[model samples]
Target: MTRETLTWLNTMTLIGHTDRRGTAWHYKASEQGGEPNHYPGAIPLKDVRARLFNWEGVHRRVAVELPASTFTEATHYGLDNKPMRWEVIGNRSALDRSDRDTGAVFGVVGPDYKIHQYSDWLLENVAGLLHDGLSVSSAGLLKGGAVAWVEVSVPENLMTDEGVEFRPNLLATTTMDGSSATVYKRTITDVVCDNTRAVALKESGAEFKVRHSKNSELRLEQARDALQIVDTAADEFRRQVAELCAIAVTEDDWQLFLDRTVPWGTKTGKPDNDYMRLLKEERRENLTYIYRNDPRCAPWHGTAHGVVQAVNTYDHHVRLPQKKEDQEPDRVSSWRTDRNLQRTVDGLFDELDRETYLDLEAVLEQAA
Candidate 1:
């Protein structure tokens, strides 16, 4: 596909706990990388209601915690008023005596994920195809409440004879934390470890993002047309993967790729210290492993795809210490690192394509 149009697949799995009120209700989020702004904390039910009325807009789902003592335990009724097995709480705030106390009400409830909603949409969009042997193999939330995605895969009988199990998947995700636009892209998931890398050779027609905004509902309604591009996307991805597989790489070529993609020690003519050298050496090793191991790049382990995977896997899986920060750089959320790595890969490929003098020959030679 055109480098000019390529963008990052910036979405994460939705992480949540069953508890919907108080501090214990929310799932504990890691704060390794400092993301003070997007801390995954729960807000009170009242505050959620306030936001709803104020038109502030929540990304996906909202959770309300009703204690058993406050409300009447009545038989659960579905939207159709049919009685369900489970008991349902009737009044939410019956126990709360204070009515006018409008202070900063903070607790753990949610702007949690709308998991069911997302799943229903996916099924409705592809119901007819699913009946024809295609199925949803994997579905989950990514990066603590940042995004939700579902991967619909081709039937096992229809898989390509690509030596590896490289199947075309329709990866659909919607962002809840406003990290990036909601994207429904056609991609190939390496079924081995479930690693999904965006298919880069050609852009899918169904692969479009709806930016998070006040009019997100309208945008979602529009996304139906985009989601229908699955068949075309799957065909193109197969073609592209086949092309990449045909190309090959050597050890020297791999080294050259590492030289080009991985950052070496800075050339300030200052003390080329032991730590810097160690850092460079570790990165070199990590890149080498990713190049060799990632299944998505298995067919093209020495080609452009391999190099991109090396960078991506390094950033996404490898834990590297920051130069200034005391702790190792933690991911801001689930898909932040993935998104950043993809962005880097996108830019590198773009430069390689457009710039005539951007080859790794010189970098490789210098290292030699």
Candidate 2:
């Protein structure tokens, strides 16, 4: 195939050919060299490969999407945009495992943002807390290689009355796809159920949506308060939960609330045959069970906060397919699910006529 020039957003042009020097790729620019931090000039593929190998010897061979962030016009490679290390198969083993997977012998690797870099940031970020005896309870990469998070316990004083050990976590996600901006959120995770809710409920944390385009350095500087933001948000979350529990929802109110929050059945009060309609029924059942059966939810059952919790917990933890094939790839992810549900429910609760308290009668009256 002929080498094609891909000029990304008028920043740089990536020109490569599969037939060039037995699968070699190169880009043209006015810079002194395509090498990161070098003055602008056209650079060959050899320079990139030589620079990477000199920095570090190969440990594990993996498929890395390149040119490196430093060279790429799209990605912002900097201290904050640290690469997260990825696990790759060993040298000979990878070749033996796949007949079609020929590895790139001459390519840049180090200084490219990967998973390990993210883990390094997590380690250093919480090093002080580790001294105080808080360990990283959970940390891993999410599916599709775009998101990762690290969870750690809050201090004893921050614990709620329920004595449940809720840990606050830091999540970072980005997409090569144009659909989303690079975003980071401080969230609270219920360890028992692995359900997560963003702590940006009221602007409580370092929740930021950063453009991958330009001015990334300034944006990263703005996110320096991420640690403090999570701490403040965690405190607020505890306080809000207590306040939510104090508000009550009577049986009539609960039923009415469900009518609005999880409306099921038809005009005839019979289940709808439509699959989407039946899903609402299933959600209602799950919400009901969460309200009635979950021990954590028992105290605040039928309350405004309780209902929200039921919805969030079900959306976050409970609604899972029993089989791999049953999984809905589009919407099941924590990032997409939490964003959609939280936005929808928050909007529902924050509507103009909606008052501070969870009064179903008041809401119904307002609607009427």
* Weakest 10 consecutive residues of candidate 1 by summed lDDT: 2-11
**Candidate 2 structure quality by residue, lDDT tens digits, 1-368:** 01112121011211121121111112224331433222122223333223221122122355433334444343534355654333343332111111123442322233332222232233333444343423333332222212233344443324577543355654443432133444556666544333455443333344665553433332334445555555566676677667665656766666777777666767778877798687777777877888788875655676655665666656545666444543666323423333332332222322211222334545546555
lDDT of 1 at 226: 47
TM-scores vs. true structure, each candidate: 0.50, 0.50
Which residue segments of model 1 deviate by more than 4 Å? Answer: 1-133, 142-146, 157-162, 201-206, 212-227, 267-272, 289-368
List candidate 2 stretches off by more than 4 Å: 1-137, 150-158, 162-165, 176-179, 200-206, 218-223, 265-271, 274-282, 320-368
Q: Give one digit per residue, the lDDT tens place, for model 1 in 109-155.
A: 22322212343344345443443434454333333323445555554
Q: What do the candidate models score in CA lDDT, each in turn?
A: 0.42, 0.43
Give the winner by lDDT.
2
RMSD of 2: 19.1
